[model samples]
Target chain A: MIDFERLRILTESAKYDVSCSSSGSSRRNTKRGLGNAEMGGICHSFTEDGRCISLLKILLTNKCSYDCQYCVNRRSNDVERAEATPEEICELVMSFYRRNMIEGLFLSSAVDQSPDATMEKLLDTVIRLRKLHRFNGYIHLKGIPSADKKLIMRAGEFVDRMSFNIELPSERSLKLLAPQKSKVGILSPMGYMATEKKQALSLKYNKFLPAGQTTQMIVGASPESDGQIIRLTQGLYKKFALKRVYFSSYVPTNEKNALLPTSPVGILREHRLYQVDWLLRFYGFKAEEILDENENLPEGYDPKCHWALKHPEFFPVEINTAPAEVLLRVPGIGFKGAYKIVNARRYGKLDFLDLAKMRIVLKRAINFITCNGKFFGTENQLAVKNTLLLTSTDSVILSQLSMFSNDEIRQSVLQGEI
Target chain B: MITFIFDGTKIGLFTCVFDAYYERRIPKTITDKQVQVGFYDNVYQIETDTQKAKRVSDCLKNCKTIGVLKDVSLALKSGRDDKFTVIFNYVKTVIDNKNLDVSKNFANESVLAFSDLIKQITYEVHRFKGFIRFEESVDGYYYAHFSPDNDITWLLMPHFASRFSNQAFIIHDVKRNVLGMYDGYNSAQVNAEDRQVTVYLSDDEINFKKLWQTYYKSVNIKERKNHRLMKNFLPVRYWEHLPEKQVEIASF
Candidate 1:
């Protein structure tokens, strides 16, 4: 029997991984199967840190041979180690899934014996969970850095999503922090999965990996600017067609290493990266255009607002006549807001009140857009910058203050309802 | 000056809409028969007519007013004040204008109000999907209990049904005295009080729950503890059913 102590240790070890999203897989339950994956994903619970605990995120074993400096499961770490068998993991996944505690399993291992050995064990658990146990839920398996191509490919067929953690943005940082892992070793499996998925598509075999691939990069671990980090993220998205590029703010787990940052990176940096990521993915922004090669994103304002501030010529576009793409470039006008403007404008010329009703964040947009040929924003660039900064900071504090008192605000924030 | 009390189902509400449209009478309020009318004004009881309901349903379906009918169904279960009137006016606008594009017509009051109501109910439905927790009963059936603000017992059925298709499960909505039962082959909703029983979890299941609760605790980073943020995602009301939120230390 698997004891609670071991489960606690494994879960504690797995908690640092911020990518517990159980989305993007849409597998129906076969007869005699215990579960299915929904495309929208279901977040079963929220931890105290406000992160969604969507899956049974646990490592098959915390025992490892490689001494990755940033990893808690490194060979030199003194943490107690335990290994779960394929059967034990299957049982836990089934039990938790049936009770609706988790969407599925996010099974990762610490290269206990060897990379291939760990990869094989993970593959065994997922295959058994599917064929033997008939558990057809979301499974996000971690691809061991140097695992065999066959093992990674076979694992992809069984799991919904697979990820190879980049950990550090650049190869130089990878060598400094995690000696055993390499950029080539990590990118090889991703390249294989991407090619296999394309081949599967051409062959009408949609069974390769439904959710595709996602990756995580630890921010602030190595001395890489957000510009360098985002460029790599763009490369991964373009190169691997990754489902998502997760940015985990570096938490100082080990301070002994003088190479790594002694303090954890502030979450605001991570938040800014997410905003930039959203702009890249949804708002059709090129990373190079958003930030120069060396420049870091500004702290006080979001990437979009920062971009709008830097270029004053794009401001005060007529909302009533601006095309959807132009509206999207406006700082406060999100995709949804842009769509609303296009849709509402068809009926008649819109005013600021109409924009407000559509839930457009006009605080920042008001500085950039004109309603029905009337300009409410200041002509002076300096005044506009101060106003935008005050509004952005005020909104942040306002959200924190208002969210503290109102349950609806807090709930909306969680649901992205605001 | 007139209130129409219907059977409180989506069909019943639509049937009332059909009747009100035919009669050319805009009702002061459309309320469920179970709830207090709150007024002595002229009250009419509307028995659900499938034929009448189908006419409205077909019209909306033919026009393919995407999300308008869905919003109507959600509004019926919304339990929000003046929702009936808002839905009625919104439907009237859609039918009158013959416009499927009224969804984004924020300038229209009824459309705006109905959209807001639908957004709320939709959000709640999505949240409940994540918030619900279950325990294994002695019969090996998974059972969960939830108290949702909206009458979404039937609404949440398809999600859980597709998820646990192979397993027999029961999701009881404590607020509305409803239960959604999903057998291995089929699924349906029933009155909770109609079928009552004492259920005891198996020892193995209980131990797993303890482990889950323990895991939940271990996963939280104390340095970044944000009670406000946690409550934002998992509201305090939902804490009752979650095994992780239990205060008792695990005996195992």
Candidate 2:
């Protein structure tokens, strides 16, 4: 058995990938092998950081030949390294799954010699977990860049979700920082799988990657602004029909790297970006509306507040008359709140008082909305902003926002481990 | 001389703590009305007597504060304004001196179901107790915050205080925004205030964050990193605490 020390290293190494949603798979458990890939396989449990602990998150090995400077496991870096064979991973995953330690397997690895070689080992383990072991569970397999499309496509069929990280926001950053990777190397496979996911789903292939594709882009590593990152995020969601766009904050592991930030990218900035991302996807606000290409997201307020403050002309929208889409544009009202307004308004005209009963954050919305032609909040934009900030319930609102959108909030809501 | 009176019912703005209670328990039984709404109407005065509201609250609070009453509510967790109203109304009938023992009198399936939910929420908090990992801030403070369903924030105190006894650490329930600070010997839990403790930005965690990020990026499968799946697992909302979420330049 690999020692707990090695286990910790391997699991911790795989923590940042953020591509492990065990929602859909059809693999079955074999008597000899240890697990299965079911839609319900990954029972995610989270900590305050919103990192999921349910999947037996591990790697085939941290051993690598590729020298990606951003990675601690880069071949040049001297770190405690370990590799698990196809069978070793199978046994560990099975044991962990059986003991109910995990809901699924989130497996990845550093490139040992070549992308193909690393990917083949990853596939071999998944294939073994399915064919030889007949283990069915939720398996999220990471796609190796520059790995053969045939192998990548094959693995796509077996895993519930597959992700190819658009690691940096742009190709130049990829070249400047991670010279070994290219625009084509990471994106070609992603393009192929997006099509494949579409084809499989279009055919009503329920057995296909049910959770679908997602990609991560490192924020603040390159010279990209929140607007650019968010625009690319919008494109990914729109063009590829992606389920999510993850923004991993750049942690300066190697201080001397010229392309990377000398210091860590602030988490609050990353948090604000996520809020903007939500507005892009769920809120009617476009990336351009949230922020211009020249500007970054406001450090003090979220993108929604920024937009509301910028366009005072949109303020004081009647809650009863405003459509669901327009209602969603308001800072305080979320998707649920919008739905409640739409539903409840059918009975009668809604006022500020009615909105309060619905648990709506009228502090932010009241300034922008009129109830029964009555306005309780200040008409002055600055006054509204000050009042909102003054009466602002920081933890409560952040907590509520986190509940629906924040990964950290999901950790608290999502039940079960593995 | 002829006199006429106008009457109608209207909902009003503003609410005290007990508005939700009346919204649920008060029957809309219009058994009696003095006049017609099309012409002369009866003015329905909105209730706003704080003293009267307090009496209703005092009774309800006493009924709810009892563990047995809450245990009977079957919410599975602490009654934090949701579905508690349902139970509060349902329990009102039997919440008296003659029927104080809820378990003995009404130990039905509703009670059992709520108990199960409580158990499930308890299990989740316990799991978080083991799963939460905090990075060392520059100032030698270990800060980890989570917004759990239950008051799992307190559940963490005994374990973390004993585990990191020598360290000054804070486990903030980001959801509740109430932080529990363990100063080695004593644990004082409080809400986040600007003047209280340093609302130090992410700069504090930057000094020692690289190793974790490096490890994180390295292990991503070049073939299969699903951003959506990852978001589903560890949503970006948590990225604020995770040292790695800030920035990473992919060194090709």
Give stretches of model 1 more than 4 Å off: A390-418, B1-29, B32-71, B193-197, B248-252
Show model 2 residue runs off by greater than 4 Å. Answer: A24-44, A47-50, A388-418, B1-252
Model 2: per-residue Cα lDDT over B107-219, one tens digit each: 23333334445665666565555335454455766677556656566666765564345567788776667788877569987866543544453562443344334434444
Q: For candidate 1 chain A, which ten residues in a row score worst on lDDT? A: A395-404
Q: What's the TM-score of each model vs. the native?
A: 0.89, 0.61
lDDT of 1 by residue, A1-418 (tens): 5689889888888887778888888888887677788889989898889888889999888888998888888888789888888899898888788788888999898888788988998999999999999998899999999899999999988999999999989999999889888889999889989999988889988788999999999888888998898889999999999989999888867447777778778888999999999988999889988995447988867888888877787777999888898889997888878877888787788998988888888777788888878988766554455556635337434345262466644654566544
Provide DockQ values for all models, in the order shown. Answer: 0.67, 0.04
| Tens-digit lDDT string for candidate 2 (A116-140) | 9899999999888777756666777
